[model samples]
Target: MASRTPAPRQQTHLAVLIDADNAPAAIVEGLFEEIAKYGIASVKRIYGDWTKPQLGKWKQVLLDHSIQPMQQFAYTSGKNATDSALIIDAMDLLYTRRFDGFCLVSSDSDFTRLAARLREEGLTVYGFGEEKTPKPFVSACDKFIYTEILRASPEAEPAPSSEKSTAANVEEAPKPAAKPKPQKVPLDFIAKVLDDIADEDDDWVHLGALGQNISKLRPAFDPRLYGFKKLSDLIKGHPKRFELQARGATNGGSKDFYVRNAGIAR
Candidate 1:
């Protein structure tokens, strides 16, 4: 019998399209970082009417991130021209066959069909939006991220009070105790997901694959939602429930991380 040749590995190339009208400027920094986990962002474009003062905040963000801004004027009243422009451009990019996937950043339900259509072509679609994003749009993508998880910490000091409010004259209200943030993704949920997706022979699974499975199971699952920056860190946090192993590449290059339920026999 002839030995089978190994297939060449190719890095995933993704096209990132942001609906500037629907997405927040604050999440742009963390959004790019999250997208980097899945693949390289080959084409980064944001659609909006730059002439509007509301979009002024995105101007500096786009320039700082090297994201191309595509202007789409609101040609008609009570209609979103930006969504139409983004959809058209998405199809154009799809036909080029250069990208392996696409990242659609918007909370609007208008892109639900666009995401489904791309998936039909065997392209991975990653959705980024707020918690209020419609269920149809969230379910259409291979994986979805809530923008709230990407927001910067709110621990910054409050802005200075107005000049008219003197320290002596101003009456301060009683400060309320800070409430603890609820855990969005439970550790047991993650462990259960790993058990179901693990290899039958060895009960071990690639950390990347496990993370993808978790996303598919829970569209809102995010490490940041639970105070961890990355999935690896989250897994490391529960050392008693999860075991992590770093395997060196056969070529002595990089290491691949794997995870399994701690209860499983080694």
Candidate 2:
């Protein structure tokens, strides 16, 4: 009998397109950090007219991050030409068949259709926007990241002269943003999901597989939303509802985590 060779994992290539008017310049650092988790960002582009004063802050950030700028003049009052420019470029990029995924950055709902179209072509689409973004746009992507989670911490304050608004509105004060309180974790919902995926073995499941299943059911499900940096921590916090076990790695790497319903006696 011959030993079978394991298939190599394919690297994901991503094209990150930002709507500068709707996405804040402040999220540049955290945005890239989060994108790195999924794949390499091969194309980084921001679309907006440089002639506008509101876009001035983005200029410095763009140069620092090596993101190419797409100039699109606002041809008519109350009309957004940037969206059209981005959509056209997205279609062109899609036709090339290079990128494995796309990360669309904007709070505007206008890009919802573009997101859906990209997914229709069988490419993964990740959306980055503010919490105020419409549900239609949020649901259009494989995953959605809120820019609020990407902002620099309040403790990392800069000199008075350096303080500036990097948000969409570009508020003059640059005050520490007041975020909403963390929402209560839906333990019942999680238990229900676990029950559906569990086998005859007391509903136990590998944590990684559990997370993937949860993502399939709720695209926007993230532990960060509950003030927990990691999913394990989030589950640990709810000791009454869930149980965890850390299985040592055979290769001396990090321990593997598993979770099961606390209600069941093993």
Candidate 3:
């Protein structure tokens, strides 16, 4: 694979389309707020029939958020036209090549294919949905966020459960007032992913490149599993087994990745 430029701090342009029928209206405000962290929500559109009484709450939010409402009335019981409209617009926008990423906000698995298709074109797809969403759609996105996490209000107290909002949101059960560190990444598993990538790359590999390779093999393989935000932080926590370099002292290129030795295990 050809090396690409480092990811920009801001997303140049992003297309955000919502399936109004499947998503709760209450999350619209926080949803856009979260998307702003990646890049601008350049194209904001929501698809569903506005005439229905069930969607009245969404009308208020649509105007507040400046989301264009695409009307698609249900032609028959149990039929959904909203999904079709959202998918059509997504494809149309995708062909223009004007956007850097896509945000598909809906709990229904109907858009799973859409998410997978967008990823095939190398677009970063960020999916937002409720906890009830199926695993297939959740795992398809480059990053999948649960609506509950985004919608968590400041006043709302945290709920006690072992459940997680994202596939990578693994949290252990709460203990009796004693806080434990997040579970550490299994050294064996890390070695397997690194060894596999190294074997494919003739015994030498870039740490940054290896991380991407690991993501391809397992979307939920996050450094956060061991309580660190970046892969470098995780590797540093296990430095005896890994080697790293700050790559940019000699040139303008940044040293943002690392490399590993083969056969290193826990």
Number of the top-ranking candidate, with TM-score as the measure: 2
RMSD of each: 6.3, 5.3, 10.3
In model 2, pairs of residues that clash are none
- In model 2, the runs with Cα more than 4 Å from the true position are 1-9, 156-173, 248-251
lDDT of 1 by residue, 224-250 (tens): 778787898888998999998999887
TM-score of each: 0.75, 0.87, 0.63
Q: How big is the positional error of residue 55 in model 1, measured in Å on the Cα after superposition?
A: 1.1
Best by lDDT: 2
Q: How does candidate 1 fare on TM-score?
A: 0.75
Better of 1 and 3 by TM-score: 1
Please report the TM-score between candidate 3 and the true structure: 0.63
Instruction: Give the TM-score comparing model 2 with the true structure, all chains together.
Output: 0.87
Q: Write the per-residue lDDT of candidate 2 for residues 31-142, one digit (tens) a residue.
A: 9999999999999999999999999889989878889999999999999999999999999999999999999999999999999999999999999999899989988888
Across 27-85, the per-residue lDDT of candidate 3 in tens digits comes to: 87779887998898999998898888998879887877899999898888898878988
**After superposition, candidate 3 runs with Cα above 4 Å error:** 1-11, 26-30, 119-122, 156-188, 198-207, 220-266
Candidate 1 — worst ten consecutive residues by lDDT sum? 173-182
Each prediction's whole-model lDDT (CA)? 0.88, 0.89, 0.78
Superposed by TM-score, candidate 1 places the C-alpha of residue 35 at a distance from the truth, in angstroms, of: 2.9
